[model samples]
Target: MGKREQAREEAAFMRGDVGVDGAATEEKQDAAEVERGKAREALLRGKAYLGREFLTWLLWRSESGEPVAAFEKTGLSVLFLGRVVLKGISGDVTELSARGAMAPYSEQVRQGMDRGLLVHQARLMLTHGEKAYEVTLDAEFLDIRAAKLPALMSEEDDSRTGERLYLAEQLSAMITTLVEAFIAVRAGRTWSKQVVPAMKEWMRGEEGTRKQTALQRAASARKR
Candidate 1:
């Protein structure tokens, strides 16, 4: 072959190699994108699941008239969820509650979460978190840190303290969302229906023990 012919052949070979590399790179990028989407979906699903369980717990507790215990038990989880909603919607916490018990938030972001939670609280109530916990949540006074839902369903590891703090803020926001739902339900029920189950059921375990103690005391007194 002549010199020009050989040069042409070499160029063609290089072009073919480049074509194969490009195709592989594209495939890799597509696969990565797919994985990311799946991860995002999983995260959302997990949050929803956690939210539901918390709501149920709250419901049961409220019905039983143990709101304070319910609050303490699910406090952290609510904080996490609140933070997520806040972060996702870019809303405020103070508007939900003037209580300084929440993580700090910017004026703009607090407003966003407040608005978003007010709109989304009903769906969230029907979907997740404990029943009473949701009731305790209020959109106007929502805490961004109070909804710190566990990331187990869609664990998003925050590599930094700042990220964790952000998560805390979202959790608080979620709690406010629940509170809003509770108020709506309360108003609908005319605040007369038992927010919890029969008070007897709520006091069952402790009251039972107390009764037993009283009976024993009477027996001892008779013997004396």
Candidate 2:
């Protein structure tokens, strides 16, 4: 017999199986429900980000065509959002859901299968598109869960275990890093007067003196 059947037989022999069956069934159901909830939530969050990126790309492409540089920014945004969503869904939904709003994304993720879609790959396509910018971030974000596997001991319960807590902290750090990356990349691509030159002044310092000299020369001509 399989291990589960063997265990059930042993429990029945001890007279505990019949008595505990109801509780056991409830617990299993609860776990499944929780997992479904988490998957759904993650799915929604991922779709939201993916939707935004797709719409942005479509609009930009229609208007100006895709800028070669924009590929990196678009890809990175999708990657970062995907990572957060995956991290939100990594463990038991009960464990992660108890933490906060990130649980909703997990819930939406669970509903994906019912829609005849594979959550993981669809998430990747939304973020990556067709190019080098394709879904590099998507791959990295999904890896967060695998990276966390070793730390989540099977013998331990989620309530008593440190894994879930540690995962939350790691996810938070990743979000912060990605936000910074997004700002830097978008700023570079848009070349906004404030963002681009300000970043250069921050990074290169005093090199903008050449631009400043040219501005002065233009002013002098207007005076003459």
The sequence of per-residue lDDT tens digits that candidate 2 reaches over residues 20-62 is: 4434322344644564454445534565443233222221222
- Any runs in candidate 1 off by more than 4 Å, and if so which? 1-162, 196-201, 204-224
Could you tell me the TM-score of candidate 1?
0.24
Candidate 1: deviation at residue 126, Å? 16
Per-residue lDDT of candidate 1, residues 111-208 (tens digit): 44334322212212111243212223322222222332333333455555556565455545555444444434433433345533332232333223
What alpha-carbon RMSD in Å does predicted model 2 have with respect to the real structure? Answer: 22.4
Q: Which ten residues in a row have the lowest lDDT in candidate 2?
A: 95-104
Predicted structure 2: lDDT:
0.33
> TM-scores, in order shown?
0.24, 0.22
Candidate 2's TM-score reads: 0.22
lDDT of each: 0.34, 0.33
Superposed Cα deviation of residue 193, candidate 1 (Å): 2.9
